[model samples]
Target: MEQAFSGRRVLVVDDNADAAELVGEVMSLHGHDVVVAHGGKAALAAAATFLPDVVFLDIGMPDMDGYEVACALRRDPSFDTARIVALTAWGDLASRARAVACGFDGHLVKPAMLDSLINEAALAR
Candidate 1:
């Protein structure tokens, strides 16, 4: 049987307020501590204080794209164990490759399945 996972601190970043909130709500429902940021800058600020175990980032934000945010997080030793995932509308091959190059541990297309989100959080454990 599969083992059960405990709650984790999750950060969701997106330019769309609704999208960020929706993801945050879903994660919270699954027993994760969730924080929603409306842009990359906000995400960085939140990460500094929240120290999330998992972060879901949107690639197309106007100010500081997801790649930049991921790179910044990766540079910080405090975030070495954090799981950063790309959660964006851009699911093309090049985009996926870029995500890896920028330090994303996983990639999920926008409107990702709820189960997938929960599973990603669980994997951070």
Candidate 2:
């Protein structure tokens, strides 16, 4: 299938270098303009420049958690409408509920298939 994520601006926030790269590569392959950040601080800085349509945030980060990042992003009027999807290893219903409460537009478990990632990104758009 032709990727549904084409031409979309996506921000990938993950502390794991390999994971970050993998996510960026996946989105790029699907024709998204992907920008990556190693932490929440960097992610916040990148947002201004990236102007991403959607943010894929890993919940477990050392410096700053995804919840903080999502909340901060939501506070900004410009990013208020931007989609914030929690990209984490947590797949349980409780985790999903927590993510929703933390302001995530959606929840995606780790090691997501390429099609699933693209589909999620499409929904965010």
Candidate 3:
């Protein structure tokens, strides 16, 4: 999984600064170019420059939910092939349904296991 993700561009968005930094650190260790965005607005700004191949977005952000972020990214032609994965605390049936409806390519239940996100994205690639 690490080898597959290495050299790839990734974006990690979370309202919690610590969580985002932790994810960024983990991805960086595996040689992925990672950008950490603290909110949906910052995520969009980063996307403009970073053009990430994969995005891990937190669903419970106070400013902008992951669903909204995914919707916005999907509307952009540039992100048509980007893997937008929702990171949520909940992993119930309803949550999965909502994620599917929101244009996310995958879903990671939080404390998001990097393995799941990476493996799913790699397979898609």
Candidate 4:
């Protein structure tokens, strides 16, 4: 049976604008209310109003970077239950450790598979 995931608030943050938008589009197709942010700063700003349930964060942004963004979000009381997932090309031990240190709830390697992406996103719903 095809599982239907109800709409959940999702934020896709990446310096690669097209990648972010693509992921956001896929999330939307799978019944998520998705928002795309092109940088860490913009992601933070969007989170303020969007109050996303899951943040698919790219770790290599220019200004703030995803770890810093995750930390900032974790500091905010409104995001206590929010899932911060690292969406990065880097899957090294150091990178994973840093994500954990920054309070990320999970990690998904970039060029995300559609099925895995949907499953991970479903966690928020």
lDDT (CA) for every model shown?
A: 0.91, 0.86, 0.83, 0.89
User: What lDDT score goes with residue 20 in model 3?
Assistant: 88
TM-score of each: 0.94, 0.91, 0.90, 0.94
Q: Is candidate 1 or candidate 3 better by TM-score?
A: 1
On the 0 to 100 scale, the lDDT of residue 108 in model 2 is 83
Query: Residue 87's C-alpha lDDT in candidate 2?
Result: 86
**Model 2 spans with C-alpha error above 4 angstroms:** none
lDDT per residue as tens, model 1, 26-61: 888777889999999999999999999999999999
Q: Looking at model 3, how many pairs of residues clash?
A: 0
* Model 3 RMSD, rounded to 1 decimal: 1.8
Residue-level lDDT tens digits of model 3 in 6-121? 77788999999998898888778778789999999899989989999989888888888888888888899999889888877878899889888988878788876777765754
Taking every candidate in turn, the Cα RMSD to the unseen true structure, in Å, is 2.0, 1.5, 1.8, 1.5
Q: Which 10 residues in a row give candidate 2 its minimum summed lDDT?
A: 116-125
lDDT: which is higher, 2 or 3?
Answer: 2
